[model samples]
Target: MTSITIDLSDSQFRKLQDFARVHGIAIEVLLKASLEDWLNLQKGDFVNTADYVLMKNAELYRRLA
Candidate 1:
């Protein structure tokens, strides 16, 4: 219902175009499917980036703990 603008790099644009052509779908339909999948990602199923970084560097945090 709403229009949005996005700019993709040449590589990204080419990849999307190729993928849509391979699947025999319109670019708009492919984009809508991608957006819906992203919107439906389970928030609780993935760790936040910062939390993941801290977890990876847990040795440095040992002193604080």
Candidate 2:
């Protein structure tokens, strides 16, 4: 496995730490799962389709809002 380093603000790090502690997981595990989920979302056509639909219907959505 490859290791990486990220720079987070103190507040951001504290939030992550608190969330991990509350969930009973290590910070590393929480970060890994978050990264994996984000990566998976980027890998599919669903995002592209959603973007296309949203843009195509932007005027209708605005009127409905």
lDDT of every model, 2 decimals: 0.87, 0.94
For model 2, what is the C-alpha lDDT against the true structure?
Answer: 0.94
The clash numbers for all candidates, in the given order, read 0, 0
Write one digit per residue (lDDT tens) for candidate 1, span 1-65.
89999999999989999999999999889999988888767453465666788899999889878
State every prediction's TM-score relative to the real structure: 0.62, 0.67
| Candidate 2 residue 44 C-alpha distance from true site, Å | 1.7
Stretches of model 1 off by over 4 angstroms after superposition: 43-65
Index of the highest-TM-score prediction: 2
Give one digit per residue, the lDDT tens place, for model 2 in 1-65: 78888899999999999999999999999999999998888876688988999999999999999
Model 1 score (lDDT): 0.87
Best by lDDT: 2
